[model samples]
Target: MEVYVELTYCMNGILFIMTYEMISLLLNINWSFLKILFLSFLSNISIVLIYIDYLPYISFLYWIVLFLFIFKKQFFLYFPVFLIVYFSILFFINTLIKESFIYNGILITPINYKDIVIVVMTCVFLIIETIYLIYAKRKIKPKDDLYDVTLIFNNKIYHLSGFLDSGNHANYLGYPLIFIKKSKIDTYQQLDTLIIDGLKKRKIDIILVDQVLVNKQSLRNVYIGVLDELDYDCLLNKELMGGII
Candidate 1:
C-alpha cells in the first residue's frame, strides 16, 4: 500500500511575491543603500557556501550584522525589517527545495527546500549587481570632461555625463533643476508639488524626481529648474544640457 501526498499546502509554498516586500523589508539604510544590500546578500550566500554544514538561519544572521557594520548611520526602524526579510527568504527557500534529495515522497526534508533557495539566491544576485552599477556610475573616466555635462537620470539615480563645452560653461544663475526624464519618472505624485510650480514659473514643463532618489546635499528642498530653452516635452538632449544661455 502506497500513499501519495502533496505538501504544497504547507507554510512555505511556491507562490511568492519578491518585490512586494523589498522597500518594506529594508528600512532607512544609508550611505550606499544598494551597496549595503548587495554586500549583505553576497555575504549571506558566501557564509552558506563556505560553511556547508551550518544551519542557514544562524549563518544568515551573522552575514546581515557583518554587512550592517560596514554601512554607516543608524536606523533603529530597520531591525524588525531585517528579521522579516531574513525569515521570508528562509521560508520561501525551505518550501521549494525541502524534498528533492529525499526522493520517494516519504521523507519530506523541510531543510532541503531548493525552490526557495534558488529564488532567494536570485534576489541576492540582483542586489549585488546593483552595487556594481552604483560603483561604476561614480567612477569618472579620463575621457569624461567635468565642466559641461548632461545629468542622465536612470534607475532612480543620476549619472552626470555628456561633455560641457568650455565656451558654454556659464552656470545658469538660478536653482538647478532636478530633472526627471519621462523614462525615469514613474509616479508623478511622489514628487513635491513645488516642482510643478517651478515649471510654471520658469515657463518650462514641470520635471520633478522622487525625493528618495536624491542624496542629501546643501539643498533643503530639491527644487525643479526647468531649462527655459529645452523642450520640456522630451528629456533635455545632452547637447543642450551641457550649457546655459
Candidate 2:
C-alpha cells in the first residue's frame, strides 16, 4: 500500500512539472525547469490531504495558491483558462490509458500492473504535449512576419513582439503611423486622434513616443496609433523601414 501511494505521488509530480512547463512555453513565458520542478514538488505535497479525506478541496485550493503566486497580476485571467485546458488534457490521457489497459486484459490493482500503467500514461502525455507545443509555437508566431521591437517612452524601455503589417500605411503629417496594443502602454494624455478606415471607420488616439526600435533599427519621431483591438503587441509600418532596415 505504501509503495503504491509513493509511486502515485512521484508520477503525479512528474506530470505536474511537465504540464506547467508546457503551458509556460505555450503562453510565451520563460520559466526555468528548476523553478517548475520546485513548485511541482510543493504542489505534490498536497496529496497528503488524502489521509484526512480533504484531498479534493485542499488540492484545488493549493494549486490555486500556486497559480496565483506564479501568475501574479495576471492570476485571475490565466488561472481559469489554464485549469480548464490542463484538466481536459489530463482527462483525455487518463481515459486513453484506462481503455488501453482494458483492451489488453490487464487488471489494474494497487500492487499489480498499475505502476506500468502510470509510467506509460506519463510517457504518452509527454508525447502529446510535445507535438501540441511545436504546432502552437509555429502557428502563434510565424518568424517571417514577426519582428523584435523596443519602445522608449516616458524614460521607460519596453520590449515587445511586433508584427510586420504591409497594409498599415496610415501616416500623420509625414511621419508614418505605428499601431500598438492599448493595454501595453499606460494611460497618457491623448495628443490627437486619427480616423482609420477598416471594416468600420474608427477613431484612435495618436501619441508620440520618444523613440522606436524595429528589428534593432532606431526611428525617431514616429506617430503611434493606439488600438484596443490589436492582436499583436505592436504593428510595424512598412514605410517605417524605408530609410532604416
Q: TM-scores of all models?
A: 0.29, 0.49
TM-score of 2: 0.49
Candidate 1 residue 78 Cα shift, in angstroms, is: 2.7
Model 2: pairs clashing at backbone N, Cα or C within 3 Å: none
Give lDDT tens digits, candidate 2, residues 1-245. Answer: 32356655665666666767766786776455577668768767766655555334666777788877766666776677667655665565456444322111111223347647667767777768766665765676657888889998888888998988889887888878898999898877778987766434567899999999876688887789998877789988888877655
Instruction: Write one digit per residue (lDDT tens) for candidate 1, span 1-245.
Output: 22123332222222112321343334422224544445444443432232345444454455456546653233234444545664565555545554433211112234334644664665575556555544553552324443222232233443432233334322222434433334433433333233223212333344443332212222223334344343222222233343232
TM-score of structure candidate 1: 0.29
Model 1 ranges off by over 4 Å: 1-21, 24-37, 45-61, 72-75, 100-245
